[model samples]
Target: MIRMIVKDLRINPLRTGLTALSMFIGIVALIAGVLVGTLGRDYLEAVNARLSGRTPTYSAIIDVTSVAGMQTTMTLQERLAHFEPGSASAQYHLNDLAIWASSGDGGLEIRHVAVTVTDAERTRVMPAPIIEGAWLTAADKPATLETVVNENARQYVHDGTITLARTGNPQQVPARVNGVIVDGADEPVIYVNAAALQRYWPQAWTPDGLTILVHPDAGVDDRHAKTALDDLLADVGAGSVSSWNRSDNADEYEQVIDFLQLGVIVTAMLLLAVSAIGMINIGLAGIEQRSHELLIRRALGATRASIAAQVIGSSVLLSLIIALAAVLISASLVWMVPWMMPADSPLEPPAYPYTAAMIAAGASVATSLIGSLAPAIKAIRLQPALALR
Candidate 1:
């Protein structure tokens, strides 16, 4: 049976090959669409994760430099002192404003920054997607006056040492420029440990800046949290608080991607419909051309089941070849994404969409079976006695 099917296809190579090519085109299109859709969604999710810290947390900055705001800042600091990490409402960080001038090759660079001071370990409030160097850690507390600078201030550090001058003193203070945070913010920010700050200016170190963190599953709604915070600060006469909330941009992106996927799916279905029609026409023509030969086989005692099997098997074989070719081509394109992307691009190439490819392969097989069904049925119903004429 296999030998007969091969011979039949080989006899009309042009027609068989053209049918396979049509199926291949449709299968490839479907696979490509799925892969691109998955990649687009993954990229958007990555961006959101980076920007929002992937957690339900709020960082509120309060101004406490004014005489009126000082009492509020101190009261908030006292309250935060009792709060512990991993609690429902945790105080992530507390810092005070510190201004210093650093001498570098490009003259003196004056930095207006808020510095984090705590016995507890404090992490980056808003970490950048791309960090050039290491962040300040709890272990770095032993190193006196080590500071992490923003991307803009990185130029002033020569040989890891930057000479900083305090406002009141004539003497220059040299501090180690540990790392950089490139969050695209214009503020020249610096985060230093409290122990380190006290070592240089013991009396000036105070908690003026605060960051409140909440667990994603903490069950605390943003409105309630904001209102409670407002009352707490108002009671102590603290200045108005500025908050950073997670943007709904990611949700918008997901909706857009869903629409794109739907579009791709519709387009792919249309292409497959065209391909299926072409295959069906080719199958009918082939069957009609070989009607006389098939009748001779039936006269030689070929059962109707055998004849139907032969027709269906030929379509399946053609489809299998088309599916394999389509999968290989789609995988090759997905693999090339990373190489084609820019070096600093935030998006990493997505993995091969195996699930999508398998679905596409199944669709290809079904298309072939459906397209050949009518011709196979017609061939099976033919009577040898009448066709012998």
Candidate 2:
């Protein structure tokens, strides 16, 4: 039976090629489905690790927010008069203000610039980067007075043991700039102890400049946070309270990935269906052409089950080859694709992803199985008496 199937295949290379092509396509789809899903999760994990590395500023930890109004039609002096020193809290429109402060060896400079947190870490800044002298720990130690400066800031600002203070004309408290290092996306930032920031400006904490922090051991609970924030700065008002959660963003990303994965599965199933059709056509056609050979086998006393097995086995052999080729091709594609290339990328071509390649192999088997269905059914339908004639 095996020898007969081989001879039959040799007799029709065209049919075999067509069968292989259909199976290959199905295998590729399956491989692609797995690669995209796995890689998407991996890419996100990489980004999170980088952003959450060692020390996360408020920006990475939070999202976009601001004071309520800016067109107050008042000068700086007018705004100052509104600063109710004794007042416990104040609230303003969330979309209205820039919140920034600078620490130099000379003193503190409050930029009050509009900025958003790009990324963050729960306790560890991600990507495990190098720090200048000391590391940021949750210890109650005074925030590192020795500062690390951003590469960009270092250009205009003095380096190597300099004093920090406000740069703009208005008077502000002075802080020391102890050291400097590259900030990455975490750059354009000034680091200061929460207490130090509060002490430095003495006046700015007014219902404004609210810094969001993690709840120790409890994790991020928005309701708990809202309550605590309100209690600490009650006069700041509910309007002043705003919340940001990394977990929330992560959840959203998960949902998108889940949707994409489902799409991939559906697509793979459809491709497999197409392959099944191709297999059935090829198998049945092959069986029809070999009716004489089958009759000879039956006349020679081969059992019906054996004939059936012979037909199915031929399809499996073709499928195995198809699966191999498809998997290799799919894996190669994945290896070549970068998870996060630059906006304007400049990199060499990639290689095949081994894991993805393995996944493609299974798709190959599935493709063959679908294609074999028709041939198997036809083999069973054969009339031994008609064939013997």
Candidate 3:
């Protein structure tokens, strides 16, 4: 029976080609969609891994104001001396410095950016790993009263660099373009020294912003930390107190990526169904065209069982050939594509799932068998006498 099927394939090359091509297209679609889904997942996962590196440093915001009749100078030096940050907090942080730009067509705008603590301090606590650039150093401080912006933040304003000045003044402070930084959030961020930051004009200013380095002390619960912070603020006799997770932005970006992934899966399934329909149609047409040949075989004493076996066996062989063709084409493309991408793009282990490929092959086999049934049944119903004539 297999020999007969092979002979028929050689004799009727056109029909064989049509069936194989139809399935090959469907298999290709299935593979491409799945690979793209895997790529998206990898991109997100890599981003997450880096962000996890930044979480321990617990970056937060604080804005404090002076009460009437304090009778004291509120210089940043005095402020840091006044209150000792816990071991978990950064001792010093950029306070009021921000990147100024148009808020997308608005006349003028500012992004609230701070230079993170020291390079070591930021690396310890960011919600994501820093990809490039160092924290603004003490020397990045004002011999000329300039700033160094964070890397990722540059994407929002300029390609690689941006300028900052007092919002309304003609004065422009030149910040030499430094390398970019990336945490998981992928935001438009900038960084500069706290003292250098004082030169920039901003809507608000405070000496009490706490970038604390909390201790590894086991007894410090959130409640304990909050009470301690409150006591610390009161004892220092200044500064509003608060602690915020640094990775909030990264979390939001990850959620958006996850939502997009779900959408791709839903859409891929629908598109795959469409392609499968095309394959099924081609298979059924092939069977229909072979009806007269089937009738001839019946006249030659072909059993109903043999005829059914021939039909099913032929379908599986054709599906396997198509699967092979699709696999070959996609594999070649994957090998070539990595070379064409930018060098800076993150390296990812692209997915080629054996289970998914098997499932797709099984589906193809099922589709082929289902496509044979109606024609096989019709062939069986005909009497040999009627069919032979």
Clashing pairs in 1: none
Indicate which candidate wins on lDDT. Answer: 1
Encode model 1's per-residue lDDT on 118-218: one tens digit a residue: 42223332334436555543432355667676666665566775555444545556667667655444655555544455556454544445555432335
| Shift of residue 100 alpha carbon in model 2, Å | 13
Task: Give the TM-score ranking, best first.
Answer: 1, 3, 2
Total backbone collisions, model 1: 0
Predicted candidate 2 versus true structure: per-residue lDDT over 167-226, tens digit per residue: 243543344543333334544543332233333443432323333433222243445544
Residue 309 in candidate 1, Cα distance off native in Å:
1.9
Q: Model 3, stretches more than 4 Å misplaced?
A: 41-92, 96-114, 120-246, 249-259, 346-349
How many angstroms is residue 76 displaced in model 3 relative to the true structure, after the best TM-score fit?
20
RMSD of 2: 11.1
Superposed by TM-score, candidate 3 places the C-alpha of residue 36 at a distance from the truth, in angstroms, of 2.3
Taking the tens digit of each residue's C-alpha lDDT, what string does model 3 give over 1-389? Answer: 78987776676787778777767666776677677777776665555544543222234344454421122222432333333333333344335444566677766565565444222233333333334544444322333233334445555445544665443445545465444555544555554444444444332224434454433234445446555656655655545466555432356556767777787667656655665566567656765677777778889998998887776677677887777777777878877777775434444546465655776676666666776666556657656776655
Question: How does each model score on TM-score?
Answer: 0.65, 0.53, 0.58
In terms of lDDT, model 2 sits at 0.48
